[model samples]
Target: MSIEIFDGIFRYGAMTLLLLICVFLLRSHRSIWPGRLGASAALCTAAYLGCTVAEQDWVILLLLPACIANSVFVWMFGLSLLKERFRPGWPHWGLMVLILTTGLWRKFFADADQMIPVVLEWAHQFIIMGMALHLLWVAWSGRANDLIEARRRFRLYFIAFTPVTMIAIAVIDLWLTPDVAPYFLMALQSFSIWVFAMVILLQAVQLVPEVLFFPAVVLEKNLPNVVSAVDQIAARDLATLNAWIEARDGFFETGLTIRNLGDTIGIPEHRLRRLINSEIGFRNFNDFLNHHRIEEAQKRLLDPTLARLPILTIAMDLGYGSIGPFNRAFLERAGQTPSRFRLQMPPGSS
Candidate 1:
């Protein structure tokens, strides 16, 4: 049996599977933040695998963008999975450097045994593993804050699936040699991607978007319109929560946890979480708090009387531990930075 034929079968078969999954992800209105990233990742992964199996130089060159960007798309998709908005930081810049160096190494220093090639290969694996760990961290850290029942349950699986799968793939690529069957290696990588697409497929079901998305946060005024299945028990709980939180100033206290909020508000912590999610339309408790906080932040940013106060002071005053969360929340709500919002909008501008 020819190795070429073996590679041809598995590689082409995997590409077809990836393309089909890609089409499924993009069909209808499913192509949104995380799903869109997922589809792109699938396409990129297929392209990367295709280029690897291609014997021709032109094929490699033509598919190089998707090939190289596979990691980037996967990283971004992982960030989006938990439904919390992602803030780009040093890792993003580091990824760019890795991509640049990897491309340069492949183009100029084709020698496999060279110091630079070895270092580059190891660095690439490190980033892949690091990104997986990051995803694990995001899922674990955000689990308590997540509200959607499906998301809460999925956290455990995600924590296990993301890191192990990613690290395993990295290790397979890093440690395996040409002595091992190349088609087997390629088929294994392709299968890993297949599992990833299937996971995303599970999330993107139109009938149950809750599995994939952040709960829709709504203003108090719009709550009645947004809530669909409020029962008598939920209604009473909602009323109690509404009356209590408005009268209490402790909500403005920094580092307020949900347990503390529940205690002060005189509702069971679990019940409070449910009410906040089902009636008020928030998945994460912090997002609910930030909704109110950012509303006040918007007012403060536009308030001429408070103009003398600094943004940090305003943020700190609103119970944010620091400026970072404050800025992120402000941007999420106002669609711009506080400084920019203040600079651009007149005090009276709506």
Candidate 2:
């Protein structure tokens, strides 16, 4: 078979697999975001492959829409970082409309200047890169830490890395000469489609019912042993856990670190980290500390007797080195600034 025909077969085969996975995820997953994002990614991959095979100016038309769809998908993922459900603000929609209109004008009616298309391509690349980086930062900084373990793992492993790889591939495509384009296309197609397929499959497995096809009696029989093992492990740490709780007020010690806390509780640092993350439901160490500190600060802020106390003084007493961090954490947890919260408190609240 000719090399061109072989490439076509491989590209189409990958695209077909991706499409099937997207469909399966759409059917099985509860959230529509994953399905929609997967569909957009598949379509974007197909469009790029089509443009590569045809090598025609008209293919730019297909490529432009694909880019637009992928941009929306990236925006959706970015939103997922901030909240469980998000409605895209006007700025997002406005940017989409602007990109589409500019693309059409450049493709159909603009002057024969090559610079315009180059500029447009770079603009789209910048936007994609920004969204990708934002998603990665959210993952790396533990903004998604509150997610269940399965979803958290998925976000970190697949969602965080995909865009970095995509952006690298795009950069390679932009800079490489035509002589190397075909090889790059082949590699990009094979790697991206397979990676996506594997990620979706893993996610599907995670979403499966825990008991699967097992009979209830068998599951019940196995459940006790599993529960017993977990309980035993937890029980072993009971003393350390109790010590940590008894010293909870010590969380307000300035410059306190997890290592210090672990030492105080007589548990190793790694073990302490695991305990807090898995059992206590805290993803970030600072978040765990802030939980207690913020609660104490809120009580002080609302107390009429302490109403005369300055916010800065309250922040310092809570182990925050500065008022800025204290205010931000308070606003995040309480949905208002300390001052605003205090104003809304009942006049004689104790």
Candidate 3:
């Protein structure tokens, strides 16, 4: 009885908190993708929790659509955090539609066939596990090279372990629950949901990072103050580092790493990381190199002498081993493939 009472209290409290979080995010940062996606996730969670408490079937009926989309919103939110120019393409929307369709089918037509429900249940679980694994992959990728301190921390905490917890809850609800589960077990599940809600509420309220809402474009507006922004490095030392990197002794190395670059330049790796993040306006080491490589590629593409040069040769000359990485980096930075970019530019224009 006591557990049930506490469970009800926590669940209700969490729902209220999630609503507040959604409201705050909508009011404060709705113009940004991360804020909007975070609010969507919060609302979905609140609706999901509400379904458990609602006595009326009509209430569940209305809230069910929103509730079933929790994972999709989470995955989108993580992507927004990763890249600044994230757009919800067909794949993202398609997955959402599939999740919604399956959910509504399972809820409305669940009893039509035993086999159908079983298949739907397994499909739903698979989708969830896939999303969880993707989020984990997204969080872990480029973590060491991530220069944004707050975002790195956010990935480590909210984006990393939270998905694992969600996966565990999903497994328990799907297959592990007995035919006649104990009341305490039920209470435990409710409490876990409440705790998940609480964690998101904290993050929404600026617990993890206020910069979580900052646009990636803002990071490129100005160069960092060498002495002020980077405490360990001085102005002259920075000039030397800049000169060395700009001269292409190491940036063009085929298999360059931050540690290797730092060792060559006689700077500590962490300080080098800070310098790139602050002074260079890049969040990743590879991004910094890609910026130089792509710039060189553009110049070469526009040169009359290189007009007949194969794109692969240009990519190889620019220190990229093959065309694939070069094309991907070029497309990401220039918004077009290398061939298209070359064709767009007049010969010898740049």
Candidate 4:
């Protein structure tokens, strides 16, 4: 009959279900740490839920365990994603402003007589939503170059969980009024249970990433290798390397690309991308391809052997659909205009 009794039952049931599922997963899978982390986070959720049902005198004690769990969840989920993408800075600070302001408005003005507890509820929702939103943004920025699968998974979590958690918080906040039997809180709690269930199911179904189990590697600032890693992702392949070289040779072929070449070699696009980055060290995929195209163009221009050929003919031959991009690429690699370079070369010179 009492709210304390009701909340306690709800929290215990939720925690029990999550723990059982975690135990099942750990048993089914050989991997240990991810399961442990998931269990830890679930336990934290249980503790926080228990806090909701605790007497005012016992609230702080019950909440402490959950707080530790929440912090751990943030770190563990975000550890692999902590490059420039998720590092706390302008975007996070800006999002924090939204959360704090919402708390201030809900606590200070929404229901003044019920301010303290309402504010607490709002603050709880604020923190969860803020984290969810931040992680979503991180996933988005991470996906800018290509749709990496891990990023898609993180984005799904942010989108699916954050709103459910926010709704639950709001329900508990509104339940402060005596006329309400706190159906909102109950509904919200149910949704929270559902969200966790989905997360458990998803983890069970999805392929675990290598990074998820690997010992963490800390990257240092000012390491040249950092930039090199990025470049290798962009450039480092011989076929990719040769593609650029052949393009510069002024071989005119429409729709030439890594994909076409990859198909020819029976390699996938991702593998080709890796080859370009690791084997050749190019920061730009298209640029790497174009550089070789331009070089070939330049040679033909400078070569007395091919000096008599028209620039348009050469441009088309080299994969340039137009003279403009070809000339620009030529100047970038050769440090001068193609015509200028051609004219400067002696009659018998290469």
Please name the candidate that would achieve the greatest TM-score relative to the true structure: 3
- Residue 24 lDDT in model 4? 59
lDDT of 4 by residue, 1-350 (tens): 76556654555667676666566546654254555555555556566555555567557454754543453354344433322212244654454455445544553456667656566665656566556556556545544232234544555565566544644454454446323546545545745665665565455555544223233222222221232334543434443435544343332466566566566655677766555444444333455556556756766777777767888889888787888978877776677887887887785664
* Weakest lDDT window of 10 consecutive positions for candidate 2: 210-219
Candidate 3, residues 42-138: lDDT per residue as tens digits?
Answer: 8998897777567788998889888788878877877777764567789999999999998889878889658887788779878988888887887
| Candidate 2, 1-350: lDDT as tens digits | 66566666667776676667656656664255545555555566666555555566667665757645555555554454333333456876777677666656665776766688777767756766776676676666553333234444555674556667657755764566345766646655555656665655555455532211111111121221221125665645645565555466576888887778768767777666666655555555676667767877888988888878899999999899998989988986788999899897786664
Alpha-carbon shift of residue 222 in model 3 (angstroms): 9.7
Better of 2 and 3 by lDDT: 3
On a 0 to 100 scale, what is the lDDT of residue 62 in model 2?
55
Better of 2 and 3 by TM-score: 3
Sorted on lDDT, highest at the top, how do the candidates line up? 3, 1, 2, 4
lDDT (Cα atoms) of all candidates against the true structure: 0.74, 0.61, 0.76, 0.53
TM-scores for all predictions: 0.81, 0.66, 0.86, 0.43
1-350 in candidate 1: lDDT tens per residue? 56566666666766787777678777743536666777787799789777766778789778977877777777777777775665446877578567757866765666876677777778877888888888888889888877777778888887877677778777876877334745666666666666665666656665557766442545664453343345877777777777666674787899888888888878888888887887777878888888878877888878778777899999999999999989988888889999998885565643
Top-down TM-score ranking: 3, 1, 2, 4
Q: Model 1 reaches what TM-score against the true structure?
A: 0.81
Question: How many clashes does each candidate structure show, in the order listed?
Answer: 0, 0, 0, 26
Model 1, residue 145: distance off in Å is 1.0
Alpha-carbon runs more than 4 Å astray in model 1: 1-15, 49-64, 86-97, 107-113, 178-191, 213-229, 301-305, 340-350
